[model samples]
Target: MTRLTALLLLLIAIPLAAARPTIDAHLHHVNFLHDSDGLETLLDAMDAADIEAAVVLGLPVTKKWEEDAPREPRYYMGDEAPVYYYSAADPLLIAALDALPAAQQRRLYPFMSGFNPTDLNAVEHVRRMIEAYPNRWQGIGEILTRHDDLTALTDGETARANHPALIAVYRLAAQHDLPVLLHSNLTSKRERSFIYLSELEEALAAAPDTRFIWAHAGTSAEIHRHQGALPKLGETVEQLLKRYPNLYVDLSWTVLEPYLLDQEGRPDPDWVALVSRWPQRFVIGSDVVGRFGNLGNIMHSFEPFLAALPSAVADRVARKNVQALLPGQAAMPLDD
Candidate 1:
């Protein structure tokens, strides 16, 4: 072809490539012993959906028993199964991904987890993971922040005093310029205040450059109970967003039946307005785990919520926003 024809073809192709939707920034891939195919299934779904990339988090479930304890935690044996926990850096995670083709590997981004942020070793572990796979991984998170755990941190009488370990991890994140995704939730039954907000604010203040992505929008309590009052939680989120430029929220695990139980059986407009104002500060996530039954239900529940969103706004929340946060990674196609 002549130079003129080549130039014309190049110009035409650029627009077509720019039209594709980028990727889903937050996707959970469970690698239970018996279910080795979970990651493959998730990748297939991403391909079918035209999702260019996905951040695959490793969540290992295990059982823990107190030292020399006569009886194990009673809750484990009941209707709710008890499983011990593991971090994202477990060897099994690398092993699982090693089997995939290089192209698929490039499409997946992994993040290390230190379930207990208070552990000193957790800090070192995360730092090493970032150093080892500087490009393949983007951040450290999916850190568990249970009510009991926070209570123990603040409790003077408890054996486990405030460790300052999470703070240390944040420091490392700040130094490395990586975002830290926290799993914070409302602890108390009362509606007056959220317990961990103060601690989180302090951490952000200490590490100004360190970004924090709050999973589930810092929602600890059931959403149904707060139905018409969804806006009530806005005050906290609004304050944090304004105060911390690096702070972000994820719209995941928000579509469960209990969380969507308003009189209209729809999400509150107040909540929508809050997010709309700062669409760049949020990302779409499925939080899918377990077999087809669980994954199917989660997908079913989230589709409508996503569809209900305004097209332009949804596009930003679903993909664009996340790409902006991680510039080193590939950017999403604008046209799509």
Candidate 2:
């Protein structure tokens, strides 16, 4: 190749190679069966995806495998067996995090997620977990409240964002300055409006001090599956962000489909504008639920939408925003 051509190619490759690394704000270390591919698998996936860090969560509940069942269920929804609260999830997560080397540990921000949100003792459970682990847990959840099918499938009283038990948990979270990742859907199947939004709003109002990451921005794959795309979701999210300073949106699986990207795979202008306006309040997560094989693809799927955003705003949503949510960690510039 000519010297001029080689020089041009080098200049182009430099920027691409140095592209900012992302922090996956949401990731699960185990599935409903409490199964995992281990921390090593996750680390390799992170390296491949150029992800600098991750907010790793544990599944709060477990799916029951019936002995009479024809085959073992791989997922929570794969069988009719009822799911129930499993407190051991947190310890497993603690064990995994503890097993990692200091460098690998630093890359993972472990959030405790194994308690019944309806039990008043849930507060004590969270407090005890924190006290027991002492400087181990970074945040509180991926708390499964108001989840569509999971709400019905879970073998207990329905879990809601405004549940009394969760209120106490929120207070504890506020006291520790820990962010809570909550999965509360805004609507149910066949509802034309955000029927369940009030439940979330009530919780937000009650815990003004706690940082609540609204998982999937109140969207869910099941809801979309039944009702198709939700209209004006962007506007609703914008309004919520305006109303609550402590509220943050989790841009994950379900929100990506119709809200962030159009059917043609183009970035939606409304979402771009909304996220650009409040970049600091938004963060991206894979929501990959204990799987790492496709982690790279899932993280990179946001590229088009992130690319559509202003460079600064895109950087915040991709990495800095989530890091800043951690207790003492500051969002350092990409160059640093």
Against the reference, the lDDT scores of all candidates come to: 0.57, 0.86
Off by over 4 Å in 1: 1-23, 31-37, 48-52, 65-89, 147-163, 189-192, 221-231, 255-261, 292-310, 327-336
- TM-score for every candidate vs. truth? 0.72, 0.92
Global fold similarity of model 1 (TM-score): 0.72
lDDT of 1 by residue, 1-336 (tens): 522233324434342222335455556565332233466776776654456676666653344444655765333232232344455434556666777898888777666663455566667877677666665556666665643433332312221112377778878876776677676664433444555567667766777777777777666434323432334466677788999987888766552233332333466565667777776777766565433223323333344344556776668776677766663543344445
**Cα lDDT over the full model 2:** 0.86
User: What is the Cα root-mean-square deviation between model 1 and the actual structure?
Assistant: 11.1
- Candidate 2 all-Cα RMSD: 6.5
Stretches of model 2 off by over 4 angstroms after superposition: 1-20, 329-336
Which one is best on TM-score?
A: 2
- Which one is best on lDDT? 2
